[model samples]
Target: MNNSRLISLLGISTLRAAPRDVHLLYLSRFLRTAAFGSTGVILAVFLSGLGHSDVRVGLFMTLTLVGDVFLSLVLTNWADHFGRRRTTILGCSLMITSGLVFAIASNYWILLAAAVLGVISPSGNEIGPFRAVEEGMLACLSANYDMSDIFAWHIVAGTLGVSFGTFSTGWITAIFQKPVGWTEQESYRVIFIVYTIIGIIKLLVALKLSNASEVSRPTVERQQDAEQEEAQPMLQSEETSVAKGPGPTALMRAVRIFVPELTAPTRSILWKLCLLFAIDSFASGMVAFTLLSFYLHSRFQAPMSLLSSLLAIPFIFSAASSLLASPISKRLGLLPTMALTHLPSAILLGFLPLAPTIELACVLLILRAALSTMDQGPRAVFLSQVVRPEERTKVMGVVNTIKTLSQSAGPTVTGSMAQAGNFGAVFVIGGVLKAGYDLALVGLWLSRRALAEHDDIVLPNVNDNLAENEGESDGTSRV
Candidate 1:
């Protein structure tokens, strides 16, 4: 089979399938996210065990973000042309390779190499074609599916993956503790095994899809054929109208298609939201690695079992919260919901360190969980409303790359702060930063005046463009 057909064999398609297709895609995403979850919980632990300093760990994660910058810039542009599915498969393969590298590496350089190859700049979150093509493909699949609802479902699956991986990794560590003579650091090697296993499954899923379902014919052929069949006089008139004005060059049109400008009101709102997201991510990143791990070890002297169970709580809450996002968005408006949830979560994160007991900590953690994830779906909806549809992938790519970089930096900063015996400082700083983020959102909502009521808007170019823009089917203009 030719390359395009081979890609379709792997589930990349031009003509969107039914909602059933998304279900399969969602399943793949869930699995992918679950594998990713293990890395989030374990990477800090692993690096610290290797006697790496907080700054070094931070630098290590930064590499991933840096790598993502170059990689995503190129890949997203490529995805606009080649199918998202094909590119996603390639990214997944890289993730698996990274996992194997982590499994064998003992020194800092090896870990750094692994981060470069596997963890740092990876698209574990956004690499999939399913997401890149989501709006277009879903619109093609069924009118019943709401973009908001789909995003909510996506977040739910993500939380589920995170919970499963985090909990499982902790359990795996505890189970192997005695048999493997587990030192705290040594236990981390097991996490790599889990990562590898997840990667392999994702690879298999990608390779098994059919490519014939994805490729479509060129658009020019259809236009030419249509012209040949039209009434002669009418065709001549249409040709005359077309010839009267010069068409835009492909490159100029593509630039406009990919990067859209936000209106004056929307611009300020989006900037504030972006700042909020950045702060929230930064704080979340800062303490994410140190908080749970330290809490479990320091307060309760608990084994892996308890930590695993605690890790599961946020996922449970997030799953529940996602189902309610759409209604909440409808009821409260996207901006309000986004800000409200995040502000409260920031408060909760700040207070988490004050819990006097493990049960209290866990409860606070659960509360934090619900509040933190509640805004995810709404935030996505908020973005879609403000920006042109075609620019979503590029915007998301840029934003995601920044988030990844912040996350990488978070661990190092938090780790260093904690190492200095000011563990509480991490939570305090993170919470304050998150609160600032929430407050900024408030300003965004106030600044924008022409904010429309929550009505559904659909784009027609979504379906045909998915294939055509990807250079898979030549019928449409390139993105």
Candidate 2:
């Protein structure tokens, strides 16, 4: 009886596991991220190595943001219609094939063409469906576990990928014991092979998943109600259970762009968030492109191998920061915690130019990494709180696409300045601008309540209400 009781307890614990999908997603993302981290930070440096000018590198970088923006705006709704699993498989296939094609690209134009084909430019949206599917799956996995902890696990996995990828790149480049024809740049091409292999693994994992395996809210109720709706046909001797294509015409095209309107409260919050994001991102963009690679290259004259190792330091700090984020949020509150972290981050970023020794620069960068990233998890929570559930995917896509655009522009402008011999000034300018953004955020908080209590607001549809003066709502849930 005692042994049976212990077995039962173990089963319960497994059922209430903190992140049920950790194994499901961790390896796939690690593979994708490893290849991505190895190249993106140092792409401009690689381009410089190939004798391309900074402007050309900047344009190459800009193409990534352009793709993200285009895809998010145009294709996001298609995911809503086609089902997220199918969308994810398609997206991942594109991602995997693009990386392999990229390995063989011979020249700058070929590389640019590879980027276009791969959609490797820069896109969270490309990967967004995977998260949607996983999160929906996790909801079915456990009723008792806190969603926050699960998200934390997701972040932990992502950081591991980044740190591991960067570290491996540096290590391999540092000790290429084989007398192969692999140049430092060629090592990046090899990383793509890793990405393709992982993509295939994830594709296999995808096959094991079922659309109906995950339970959504009020699952039985929704199914019953949907069946009821389909039971009766009112017009033209036929009943349509699903919304059909809006039809193919110029008028339909115009209607598609204009029909889905964001609510007023959501619109207001979105604009403020966008303004804040744009300001913060411009600074972040500049830092993102130049910070690690340029500092290592210009100040320390570090090679690709050492550069990879040095890049690991920041991601390591980021992983630590994410681990401690819950306790930090509990102590500081969300917005204040974010502001406090950024103050130091901006200061450290500005101090980069002043570091007299390579050691000092690394120390400052690590410090900046720890503080700057503490906000990421909490910020995601805040986003969920501010938007309705049905609209969450579309809203997130729009906001993330904008953020990507701002980040994409940062590298281009900063690369130009660095090439013009004004790198120091750019750091100072970025820091001050970010500091101003921090101040603006603080002001926004001062005007509002100390903390926002989550509220679920559902609006009644006009047509549905007309059927009965008794109003009905598709339910919404919030904490």
Candidate 3:
């Protein structure tokens, strides 16, 4: 009975029942995050080794995120209409490009250009349109109730990948330097080389996704949209001959661009959610794991290997904590679970800088880790419940873009502070902002009322097949 309960709570059935495509998505995320994790550990150290100042390192992160913001906005907005698979492939390709360039080049301007033009993660967080697109796909790929379970395992895969990457990268960095007499930059480049290879593997994995992962659109409607596409430019071409105000064609096109992607009701709820998320993410950006690792290294003189081992603890604990998210959300509801668990974690973050010893800081971080990430699965489930299938991708894109835009400045702020010897304030301010954001979510936004509770918005159109994707099966649950 205990074993049965454990399997049920862990949602082992959900994993076993998931389709191959869903599994592919999970694998892609795991590989991507492993690359991200390794880079997170080494990026600051690499820049420092390159003789860049703290502020330059911070600016590098800021620009990386700013570039990410634009990239995410464009790709996510086009993903549903253009093709999810293509978007993912492009993203992976960009990751490969960024990793290769960073591995080969040491020039700051060149590295910054590569980062801005392609995909690289300095904060060790998801940094592209992949998350938004995948979340949208995941929402449609499974039952609404199973969403949280899928997300839980997804988080587990990601955290474990991070743990593996960070731990491995640390050892690799140390090993390469020990007897090989390799310089610090050479050691770090090895990780980026590995990152580039992971991107290739992920790209191959992404190519295997079945049509079941894409959003369903009607066949005739697709034909219509395609036909309209070929004629839109010509239609707009006639604007030169038209009488004032550009023309009807141009005006309608402009309106379409200006119109909100979501429905009025979804907008009403989601705008607030976006704002709260932006605030929370800004706080997160302030203490990105890379910066945190930098702080430890600079302040306590922690070695790279030891620093990575210490930093990886939270991801492991966070992964385990995510397993509890589904059940906890089921009991406490998503928002309540998110708010209640997060507040304490934020408080712990507030106290992190106060720790006089690394051991105490790790203890506080472990405790904070146990709670900080418990909300992810619930939040995914909540968004899936609240947003319609057609709008999910854009909604995620918009929200994530907003969050990234807000977060982009945080590392710079933290960087400036570290330059001034006020680095410790980053954690304190981040914690307080995060705590207040959690409260505002419940208090000002009334998120505790549970948007999913007011009306149980469910997805029921997984079979809305496309003509081009004619033979693709839904890849329904297994035995």
Candidate 1 lDDT trough over 10 residues, lowest sum: 457-466
List model 1 lDDT by residue over 1-479, tens digit each. Answer: 89876433322332234355556556666777777676666665566668777567666665665565455555554453465557667777777788788877788887777666554322223332234344333322323335566666667777787788777878787767877777766677777777888777876776654442132334324433443453233333546547865333333335533333323343444554556567777776776643456545555766666776776777788777776766677666776787887788788878877878778888888888887888876665555444433344444554554555566567667556766776776787888998888887777665542232233322122112222233332222111
Q: Please list the residue runs of candidate 3 whose C-alpha ends up more than 4 Å from where it truly belongs after superposition.
A: 219-241, 244-260, 444-479
lDDT (Cα, tens digit) per residue for candidate 2, span 225-279: 5434543332223233224433233344454442333445566777787788788
Q: Choose 2 or 3, whichever is better by lDDT.
A: 3
lDDT of 3 by residue, 1-479 (tens): 69889998888888888888778888988998899999998888789889999999999999999999988988887787788999999999999999999999989999999998898888886888899999877776774237778888888888888877888888898899997989878999999999999999999998999888887677325534644664467564555646455675666556444232445556776787888999999999999988988888888887888888888888899889989988887776677778888999999998988999887888898899999988887777666656555666777888888899899999999999999999999999999999998898667435333443565532212122211234232222100
Q: Superposing every Cα of model 2 onto the true structure, what RMSD results? A: 7.9
Residue 93 in candidate 3, Cα distance off native in Å: 0.3
Model 2 segments beyond 4 Å from truth? Answer: 1-19, 121-144, 175-178, 210-261, 289-291, 450-479
Q: What is the lDDT of candidate 1?
A: 0.59
Ranking of models by TM-score: 3, 2, 1
- Candidate with the larger lDDT of 1 and 3: 3
Instruction: For candidate 2, list the clashing residue pairs, or say none.
Output: 64-121
lDDT of 3: 0.81
Which of candidates 1 and 2 reaches a greater TM-score? 2
TM-score of each: 0.75, 0.78, 0.88
